[model samples]
Target: MADMNFTGPEPDLNELLAARPQLGLHAQDGLCLENVPLNAIADQYGTPVWVYGAQTMRARFAALRDAFAAETVPMHIHYAVKANDHLAILNLFHEQGAGADVVSIGEFLRATKAGIAARDIVYSGVGKSEAELETALSAGIGQINAESAEEVDMISAIAARLGVVANIALRMNPDVDAGTHAKITTGLAENKFGIAAADIPALYARASGLPGVRVAGIAMHIGSQILSTEPYRHAYGKGAEMVRALREAGQSVEVLDLGGGLGIGYQDGPGLSPAAFAAMVRQATNGLGVKLMMEPGRYLVGPAGLLLASVILRKQTGKRFLVLDAAMNDLMRPAMYEAWHGILPVDAAAFQGMATPADVVGPICESADQFAKDRILPDLRPGARVALLDAGAYGAVMSSAYNARPRAAAVLVDHGGFELITRRQEPEALWDGEIVPGA
Candidate 1:
């Protein structure tokens, strides 16, 4: 069995807030996200709500774009929709001149519905169904990143049936470890993601022959939460070599889709800076005139949002447990990835109290629903609220209706105001489509 890697020591609230400038605290307002006090949000919208900063997303997008532009690298950013599929978020990116990187038909449709042109959306996934391929081709998507030879053939047949040319990039597995968790790594040889690097050349040749396929270029995504740039240096360096070799072999490779796994500072630690990342890209793909593209998901939104939860009760049975009304069903990253998210009290007075180590848990029945264990936090009384920081990416998108717990509401905040984008799921909505036997 593979060894598990856990998060290191948690950072204090001050450090966490300092790392994320979008969040602020006030004497009277307590915690404020992008000019709107979170306590006000909790009072009006109730707890277990997701709050996102629109201005933060816009700023991050511009920062990434400017970084690549500063190095004079022709890069196109396709927002990875799977990270946060909310239409409001998608529309925000689209408004910022970003494209969409979708993995399924549903995401594809969402992107289109959010005013993103079909020509600006790239379809990528390991296991796309025939129906999905047909839909993408029919919609005239910009490109389809074929992950396997089987998928290459599948796209060919589907595009031929639709009488359209399917733009494609062969997603190559570079066999490089991204130095991230085992569950999220994709570039390794053992992972079931992209096609093997050796297999790409032959598959590219095969794809060119299909009447319905246009071989655009290559694509790769090593893993998620990648901190260091060395793995990318190795992967993109190899990718550059492959492009040169393929061009020598008479392939017209016009695009290099460097799929995104750029990490965020979840623990208030330093993350890979956009400038540093762009510098690496400049060096790795230098003089390779192909148009560069990236599919960033978390890096743009991870630090721009958080989860708001209220304390339900404080259980003291030999050990202290801070039970919250929000459970794994609302934000599953902790329960799913053993992920670390800084928890901050929503009251100014709470921060003044003495800190103690306690288990921060949720209302979920399973023991795995715990968020933090033996973590130092200030005394939080019942009815007090806390914000789970750095939860913007995989928080609400991964939520479930487990234990009949309704999914939480989502809000988008801007300059001194907030708007509820997604309403809290009604309890009856969970079984809206279910039918009793013989009813």
Candidate 2:
């Protein structure tokens, strides 16, 4: 019930590295992700690149899986594709025995292309189009989360036309406040995410009667970057009550898709503990006897990555502005959600220097291109490099080519080395497929 807003004194470099165990600050070599120095990566890949620690991601998944296992709960983890949709990341999760939770046909296809089995993908989104639904049904995904009666009807019609039964779970809007950012909250009644909890019974009946629809269970996703389990306890409790009501009415319920929103510390703070979260799930849905599925996106990848950018130039008028080549187009969370990401110098010596307040900004024309305001960091010169910590999830995936700046490259670090997963967008490729109508 306390304010969920992130607030605290600025964490020093040691504190930042301590909170994120995957990052290490070497006395001479500088900051290293996993085992490879971030400077080495920036030197090779150039500035404004995304560097991910493969082992960190793997360990996070294991921790979550183990947490559920310890609670004696059978949980199927579907890595939320929208968080970071790079194929390499998806493939890594898939190889680790995780499924894919996707929102679009493109994501579904990307999951499959990443070697996730078609039956292991869960297609979820409020505005699924006819084409998207048809594609999902064609691929025979594990389940389609229906957000409305109209969506159920559409799925039924499409499945009937294709002569294939579509497995579905009604996404119930429990109207629970997840205590996250208002823009990211999806379970509120006003938000356009899921079906009303009151309408589920009748809609479940309708879905049962539909020829090509198979009612699997229920799903609820309150919001993203949720740092507490209280909202989930409330939402899952409501979902369990609904399942009991449905089963009492002689309807079969088998799956409970507890969509993920586990938050991570972007500022050396604690996030929702996986063990605590699993315990909440166990306590809430104890007697339900349904298979549990979680779609974790940020929790698994957020802390494992950082955005590497080089200082472009220092400008001082009334205030200091440390400009970088990266922009909001490269990492939009700050601009979009007013999010916070720890900025650390890539060089350990620089990080150890005297700290000063400055606005860390990007080359974008928009004023919102700023990464941090009045942020305290060691004085940085042009050509010096810095890393925006905890950007593995929403950073690169949400990037765009705004202001004619091409998207940055992405690299995965592991085994004392790194490999480029996505190359930096070439300037000419921006117009490769774009056409001038009159020309």
Candidate 3:
């Protein structure tokens, strides 16, 4: 809940376009993602639609994979499914030889449905119910990152009953600050995320003696939207020390799950460099012979998608308000995380126009539904279209029907063409399962 207000000179539209190469302004097509005009999609599917660039995702995955390869680290990349759990996105990562890092059974099922083998999916969450553990164990999940001692015992009992050995890593809370938002930070001792470092040695020893549990290694995740590698170095250094301690105490360690929080540049600034991150991991855990695994969510997909919305109308009073057809129900990050996403006009002329400050908002009744405060943009008349940039992750996947607004349609742009990945939710579908009892 940091200061949400933005007070400064407007970001240059051309500069924004330059930062994200996937997007460009065309003379005839206006704003194009991977050279596909966004306005065409908005016009055909109606406004309040989501457009994702498949090529962009593929390039990002390659970049991260190659970065680790350059450092000579045998890294296993797991696509964090919670960020954007669309089957198309999951399948694309699977094709790139990436595994799935899921936190829930539904996400696990979704990853498998996308053709990701259950054995390639690693379950990580603070709370895993008995049913969920049974389901995951029944499906032969590859690895589970146990958060608490109780969870370890729970997994042990369930696995013993099923007569199967479970492969798990102790998720250690390194108490390192990731210099991110308060809500997203998970590595602190106060955060209810992982087991404390002091408890790991004893837990590892205890779990090793259990009937159906095997202590693979350790896992640690500090936070989301992390820009610096120093926090990771601190956390990973602690993890390495714990690994050594466990080994010294006669324990076998195998895999080190480096939880993902590699952030993207929300504004025009540079994001966390994969090369720098890989180098830091190398420097921190260089001598440890354990296998390296990273679960990256935002960094892989956040910049590859956008929300296309049409201007409902422009209101002017003491403050200029630009109302959009898309509401908080469509993209909640702006209201939920107070996140900043670059907004650009779909028309080339509008992009070149003189900018003025206006409060960009959705039609939701709540005041918190505002997307941007005092954002500078061109005079977008009614029916004008705009694209909210860097919304590929934590955008549509987090959407809801709070105001009874049906979810928006989704299109995937690839190979110089676009196709509907998810059709817009019909209005009647909202209440399809509801019942007016005793009417």
Candidate 4:
């Protein structure tokens, strides 16, 4: 939503959410973010936890899906498992008829466990192990997007060994820049992600000769957090061209997978709208004649959740610094990409007026753990709660307990509002497998 077309004039989270209140995600019970402060949530669910609004997830899926459905391109929304792997969130998307783009065997198992059909799950990753492959095969996964020629042959061999024909697609690099955060870009030629587009023909020829291998389609993942549709159109157009070529060469290509890099609102304008993004895909691949597939992780869940942390210490050294109990280990994007996230007091009652310019920081040893630098905030005090906005995507999914600290808990807010989803990791589990040599 915050016009990512430009670099200057960056909008923060407060401004972003205010513009798209619908995306702010309210509970089915009418619990809106504006009315419920996360501090109270932290107090109830404990600190360093994730909270999601079920209503938000459902709405996002509908908005994005409806936009693409207007055209003939059959859009398949595969929720990216890496975004936020909470089973509850995954189940919510599943109820909305969303498939999963799983990258690991564990994710595959989890998806099936949550009652998602294995036929709806698509295995996609650059570095999948033999066990992971077998797991997916045994589970009857619909298709596997092989990133390398070797993987294509290997999977075919596995499928042959198992006496089954495998559905496969080549993940091709379109050699286009997604113009997003570099940490997330996956489709560039310089990156070690997908197969190059130029070699698609040769690879198809080779794959055609492989036994028990069905080259079902082609896929292109330019990057993550893409705010523009130009890059998607470019990548999709190439995929369309490849599909045409493959069919001419007597290869059966039935699906066209456009990798998900859709970003949600992080700072303040409305985060990238799925409806707008979907329209672009429909126009680009309207008559491709193959089932259109998209794997969106962040855009579906990022706006539905928040990371609730407690203010630990407030220090001033000619500048106000508010330290929090949660650190980079809890939410790593802000430190990793220098990303922007909205910080709100847990108490909406305290937000009636402007306060002071303070840095909302975490207790991580690294100085980069700071959430916001030199941003005006309320006069935060110890024990006060602050809500980290748009944490629904990579927030808790990428979390680590690096500093010997326990992991946080997760809660779900539905019509009933705020039910515990996952319990925070306790210190006992940090050393649960440790041995003291028969002490």
The digit string of per-residue lDDT tens for model 2 on 338-413 reads 8888888988888668988899999888998889988888889999999999999988888888888888999999
Q: Which residue segments of model 1 deviate by more than 4 Å?
A: 1-9
Ranking under lDDT, best-scoring first?
3, 2, 1, 4
Q: Where does candidate 3 stray beyond 4 Å?
A: 1-10
Candidate 4 error regions (>4 Å): 1-17, 20-40
For model 1, how does the per-residue alpha-carbon lDDT over 1-439 read when each residue is reduced to its tens digit?
Answer: 1113335556776777788788888999998998789998898899899999999999999999999989998899999999999999999999999999999999999999999999999999999999888988998999999998888889988888889999999999999999887888999999999998888888888899988999999999999988889999999999999999999999899999999999987777767799999999999999998989999999998998899999999999998999999999888887778788889999987777899988999988999888888878888999999999888998888999999999999999987799999999999999999999998
Residue 431 in candidate 2, Cα distance off native in Å: 1.0
**lDDT for 20 (candidate 4):** 50
Lowest summed lDDT across 10 adjacent residues in model 1 is found at: 1-10
lDDT of 1: 0.91
Candidate RMSDs in Å, in order, are 1.7, 1.7, 1.4, 3.0
Error of 4 at 130 (Å): 1.4
Evaluate model 2: give its TM-score: 0.98
TM-score of decoy 3: 0.98
Worst 10 residues of 2 by lDDT: 1-10
